[model samples]
Target: MAVWDFAMPSPLHLCRAFHNSWASWTASEARLRIATSASDTTPLPAEAIHAPPLPPPVDTVYCSTDAGFSGPDRSPTFGFYVRSMDGAFVAAASGPLACPYDPLLAEAMAIHEALSWLQEHNYHNVQILSDCAVLVASFRDAGSYRSYLGIVLDSCLRLINSFPACSVKFVRRGSNLVAHALAKHVSAVEARTVWRDSLPPFISPAMI
Candidate 1:
C-alpha cells in the first residue's frame, strides 16, 4: 500500500487573499465617491441662476412717462410713450413745460399730460408707469396737495378718474429708458414734438 500526505492552505496565505479582496473593494468605493463629488461641485451658468423674472402678460395698454428738469427754477420737459401689451408702440409725445417747476411738480405734469393724451386718443384701459416713487405714492394715497404742485396733482387726480380703467405704477429708471430719453430730447429742443405712429430714431433703440 502507498502512503498519502494531505496539506491545507497556510494561515498567512489565507490572510493575504482576504486583504487583496478588501483593498480592491475599497479602491472602487473611493473612485465612486470622487466622481460623485466632482459632479456635486460643478458650477451652474450665471443666467440660469441670476436672470430677472419677466413681467406678467397684460390685457391693457401701457405707457411710460418721465420728466427732465434742468434746475428747480428752469423749465421742465415731459415725455411719454404708449405701447400695447405686446410691446407695439402706439404714440409718443415730448414737450417743454410752459413754466419752470420743481421736480415733483414736473413729474406730476408729465403724468397729467400722458393721461390727457390717452384720453384724447380714446384709450380707456391704460396702465401708466413712472420712475418717480413719490408721484406713485401720492396717487395711491389721494391725499391733499399744496402750492403749485397741489394744483398739478389735483388735475392729475381728475384726469385719472376719467378713465374707465387706469393704473399708475412705479418702475425702475432702466425700464423707463425710452421715456427718459424722450424727456432728455425735449429738454434740449425748443418745440413740442408728437409722434402718433412712429418714434424718432434716437429714441427707437430704447423701445421695448
Candidate 2:
C-alpha cells in the first residue's frame, strides 16, 4: 500500500480539523473555475476586463446585493439592484448560483455576479453595497489571501480595480431589503429574474 493511504484521515477528522483551523475567519468567498476556463483568474474574465481611460465620478450609481438559500444543500441565490444617482431604480436581477457554496462563499458569489452585471452594462462608476461586512472587508486584504476563498476575492478585487471609480461598501440589513427580497424570492422559486424599467409589485413594498 502507498504510505499516504495508510495515514489518510477520516472524513470526520478532516472536517473537524478544517473547521477548527478556519473557525476564526468566516467562509464568505470561494474560488471557482468553469470547465472551459484557461486559468483560475480567467474564470471571472479578469484578463479581458479593461477600465476606461477616464472613468466617471464615484457614486454615479448605487448597487446592493444579498444572498438567499432555499435549503442547506441547495445552491444559494443572489439578487442585486441598481439605482441612479438620485435613487431611481435602474435595474434589478435575481438568480440561483451556478454551484453549491457555503453561505459565506455564496454571498461572495453574489458580489461577484452583481459586479459582472454592472460591468457588462458599462456601469464603471457604480458603487456596490453588501450586507455581509466580512466579505466587504475581504477586498482590503485579498492580495494576501491564499485559500479557495482568496482566489474568489482576488478576482473580485481585480474586477473592482478595473473600474476607475467603482467600489464595494458594507450596507446595513435595513438598507438592503430590496436585494434581500429579490434573493429570497428567487431561492423560493428556484429560478431567476431580471427587471429593467418596470418592476413587479411585490418589489415595491421592499423598496419602501
Candidate 3:
C-alpha cells in the first residue's frame, strides 16, 4: 500500500470529499427507500377485501339477470345465469324478445323467463339478482304496477311465489355483468341458447 498522501489531500479536500461521499450515500439510501416503497405500494384507492355474500340456505340456487339492447328501437336480448349457493355453475339461459320492449319491461321479462326455466327444472329453492332498478321497483314500489310493464312484473312475482323458496332482489350493475355478457352473446347469435354443463366462452371471466 502507498503511504498516506497527506500533502496532496489537505484538510479542505478531505473534508470536501467526506461531505460529498456522505451526501451521495444519503441520496443513495433515500433513492433505495423510494424505490422499495414504490415497488411495495398498492394501487391507489387500495381496494378493500370484502367479505363474500353469506351462503344461502341449503339447496338454494343463485341467479342473475340482465337485458342487452342492440340498437335504438330494436329488439332486446335477455340473459340469466344460475349457480349453486356454493358458486358452482348450475345453468344459464338467454333469448331474444319476440317483440322489442323497453328496458324496464325487458328486464322484467328476463326475470320472468329465468324464473320459468328454474321452475320447469324443479329448482324450487332459488335466489335471483336483477340490476334493473325499474323492474325491481315494480316489485318493491307498489305504485309502479299501474303500467303495462306490470304484466311482466306480475308474472315474475307469481312465478317467484310459486317456488317453495325464492327471492328476487336488486343488486348493483357490476354484480350482474355475467348476465349482461350472456345477453350480448345471445344478441350476437340472435337465438335462444341454454347451457346445462359448460357455459359459453364469453362467460369465462365470471368463472375466474
Residue 107 in candidate 2, Cα distance off native in Å: 1.0
Rank by TM-score, highest first. 3, 2, 1
For candidate 1, lDDT tens digit of each residue in 79-104? 99888988888898898875465777
How well does candidate 3 match the true structure in TM-score terms? Answer: 0.67
Residue-level lDDT tens digits of model 3 in 1-208? 2246654566787789889999999999999999999999976543445545665679998999988777555668888999887788889888887545577777878888899999999987898899877667678754457776767777777898999888878899888888888887734337888989977777776432
The better candidate by TM-score, 1 or 3, is 3
Which residue pairs come into collision in candidate 3? none
Residue 173's lDDT in candidate 2: 95
Q: Kindly list the per-residue Cα lDDT of model 2 for residues 1-208, writing each as its tens digit.
A: 2247569777898889889878644433222234334463433465456644755474588889988886656657888888887878789889888645577778888889888888888877878999999888878888777776787888788788887688889989999998888888844346677889765567876464
Every candidate's lDDT: 0.82, 0.78, 0.80
lDDT: which is higher, 2 or 3? 3
Model 2 TM-score on a 0 to 1 scale: 0.67
CA RMSD (A), model 1: 14.6
